[model samples]
Target: MSTLPVLNNADMYHHYSDVQFRDGCSVIHEMLKPKRGESILDLGCGTGRLTMQLASLVGDSGRVVGVDPDSCRIAVANEQLKKMDDIPVTFQLGSIREALPLGPFDGIFSNYVFHWFERAERAEMMHQMYDSLKPGGRLTFVLETNQPQPNAIIRDIFRLTEPNLDEESASGMKMDVPSVWLQHCSDAGFLVELSEVFRTEKAGPNLDAILQFLKASIPNFQPIKLTDDGLHELDSRYKTGNGDEVAFSLTVLKVLARKPQES
Candidate 1:
């Protein structure tokens, strides 16, 4: 989930995120094991779904800050925050590339986010995350691994449809391998606790639905504006007789690492 500061429709994206992604992140949360009274940062906490969950896990005494670059999603997150007065949850519009919300947090958690930062800046970003954490604080994140090759349909869509996107920008969307990311954590002086890759398939009602999900969630695709007719044509051309439903596989990497306590 790259930070789209100007999302086309935050509400629609939030809806699909809840339907497809929220449940899968439960395992990442378990790996985090946030405790009572701990202050945590939910990096790229789109619409605050998992951030709110972290608030519950950390309990009433704990504080959780959900930060994202998109003001639209942050607005949605704040709207939801009104109902959660009893919980110490806050939503902020910010980019990790700019600065994290004030923190020497006990833990930092992100989902499918780190890879979205500029490739050249990633090492510095990792170091910044490290600097924001308290001694012995943990950093846990899960992201889709870079496929050996981009999906043909998606690649074609970007290459053909997105007039504003260039070759380099499209290539930047690919995530790094698990080993490279694990090395990032190690380079940042984190004690690597876990690093593993897993696969999951996401199903949708139709190709159109899946495309909408991607358009809503992916920053690079924000420039793409397709009408109902266009989507129907897409479905007709690429659906491969899968009936009205579509499923796609994701190669995901989960990493948990901790800052060493002061000597």
Candidate 2:
């Protein structure tokens, strides 16, 4: 396990249990199209939502290894999979920057996880993925694009609270645009197969739902200290637009690459 302390792993998993999957995972699933009996690595497999789905596709003959930095999340994932009798699935607690236990996998799948690494470290992580995979192994990852919704009131509040926050601090990591990410993959010796950007709108049924979503999705926002008046103002603004139907946009970049046949 990594020595680095993870912040509120159990809270994170519990908060995101009902969170909806963006289009990025769907793109990865389409690109991967995991065949029976193929080995897969689900890097940063949070609560095993997508990991479980991948396991189903891989079936009993195939192997699925789900790894996360948070031990609590790993525990939750293991608990979730414990009831299943036939699927060949294993869960590990680790970060992508560290050495992985098993490797040369047939496919690597990640969703909404890579943006957590610093830009300087991202290339090395990609190289690590390259090293962990067999020649011609596929790598699919989904990352957030740094585009906020236009005329977004909630975002305005977030900006007001933390205007000078660094990208790494605000996001709990760094993120790059699609082009830069693709370049990083190419530099890591992966043959770029597919890359694209897509946007999605998330709707919270009520102010509480929106706040819960924010607390789960954005780590920096979780530990925020808001005064009573500030909280009231935020709630009032969120309730103004659509009677508690708060809508926010997310921009995501999806990439699918393959390790070189010789590397």
* Local accuracy of candidate 2 as per-residue lDDT tens digits, 176-222: 66788888888989999888787765666765666665565565575
lDDT of each: 0.74, 0.71
TM-scores for every predicted model:
0.83, 0.85
Best by lDDT: 1
Q: What is the TM-score of candidate 2?
A: 0.85
Candidate 1: segments with Cα more than 4 A from true spot: 1-6, 97-101, 149-168, 220-243
Taking the tens digit of each residue's C-alpha lDDT, what string does model 1 give over 120-149? 777787888899899999999888776544
Model 2 residue runs over 4 Å out of place are 1-5, 9-12, 15-25, 97-99, 151-154, 163-168, 217-220, 227-243
Number of backbone collisions per candidate, in order?
Answer: 0, 0
Clashing pairs in 2: none
By TM-score, how accurate is candidate 1? 0.83
